[model samples]
Target: MAELKAGVVATLETIRNHFPSHVITTRATATGGAHVIIEDVPLGPPYNQATTWVGFHLSDACPYDDTYPFYVRADLSRIDGAPLRCPPLHSTGQVFPADNSTTDTRDATMVSRRQRDQASFVFESPLSKLIKVLKWMLEQ
Candidate 1:
């Protein structure tokens, strides 16, 4: 099997392929952190989501010969500034103030598959257009 770069660049491609309707309005600086603004489209909606400066460290066993999602992370959300809103979990294992972990929801629905002892999140949103792409990928 082939693989991709073990870093943020590959994750960015995953985001683009999964959410093509969303636009990366702003790219991060050379420092590996920046704001990604996603605009809702006609088929999608009118919501602008931003993930500012999400960390992009790589793992030890990344295969650069091919291309794929190299890193594993959780939900991406807009960072707040002293707001009354709750923060989004960067990883599914994180705990929330309501005495529940993000993993609960994930465990309830997502199937688990492991590689090299690292886990990844996977769920097919019926509303996600990525499913169409996935179907096409399987056909080919």
Candidate 2:
């Protein structure tokens, strides 16, 4: 269990280094694994209904066994005024906060949008080659 948590932390740190502009948070899932929320990236169209948001899932055994494991999902849909069960059970688990030091929601939204756009390009471009390097490091 400790090793699994370590891997989760390491993955979060790696993502933070690679995508510094994102608002990253972590939560303990009911399954005893962790879920990393990349808040601010809106789910487009169909899934954008009041209850759904998109993010990724990280586990002890990832990448090698799970290709394209960085899932873009709308699993954050809210229900009955309560958010989906992604929050940490006991306390906040904010790994990174949106850079809205002035408490401006617009600024935070814009930053998140920009980061999402940049990430899209990076993932689509040759920059994705870096994933190989990251995978190798994770293996080590």
Candidate 3:
């Protein structure tokens, strides 16, 4: 097990506090961050499933660093039967792209929503980024 940074721990605490009902798991990284996954996250219109898990890497540089390219259940599709548009990264024997150290058990669709404005990125946290990604996915 790797030690977690204070910022990463704080962000994880916030996530757990907000989504009290969800199952959140973490695998600490050598860099003092963690691989996080929140299961059973509710989905909205346009999505085929009622809920799915969301995963992301909260690096040691958290709070100061933006969490990018989240992961969701790979089989996720639109209810309208259209293409997902976003590229899906299947987690078969391939290691996740972020750190290339951890292997996620679930096959996931990579959601590439990064913080565009460097000025406003200071205001973004892991929890906030996750929420924004979920909202963006639901809207798409």
Q: Give the TM-score of candidate 1.
A: 0.27
TM-score of each: 0.27, 0.36, 0.88
lDDT of 3 by residue, 37-127 (tens): 8999999678889998888888798878879778887777789998777444223222243566745466667787878787776698788
Between candidates 2 and 3, the one scoring higher on lDDT is: 3
Please tell me which predicted candidate would have the highest lDDT against the true structure: 3
The alpha-carbon deviation from the true structure for residue 10 of candidate 1, after best TM-score superposition, in angstroms, is 0.6
Ranking by TM-score: 3, 2, 1
Give each model's whole-structure lDDT.
Answer: 0.28, 0.36, 0.80
lDDT of 2: 0.36
Residue by residue across 4-117, what tens digits does model 1's lDDT show?
333435555666676676654433333442223333422211112322111122222322111111111233222332221231211233321111311322111111212222
Q: How well does candidate 3 score on lDDT at residue 78?
A: 81
Stretches of candidate 1 exceeding 4 Å from the true structure: 1-6, 41-140
lDDT of 1 at 111: 12
Q: What is the lDDT of residue 131 in candidate 2?
A: 48
Q: lDDT order of candidates, best first?
A: 3, 2, 1
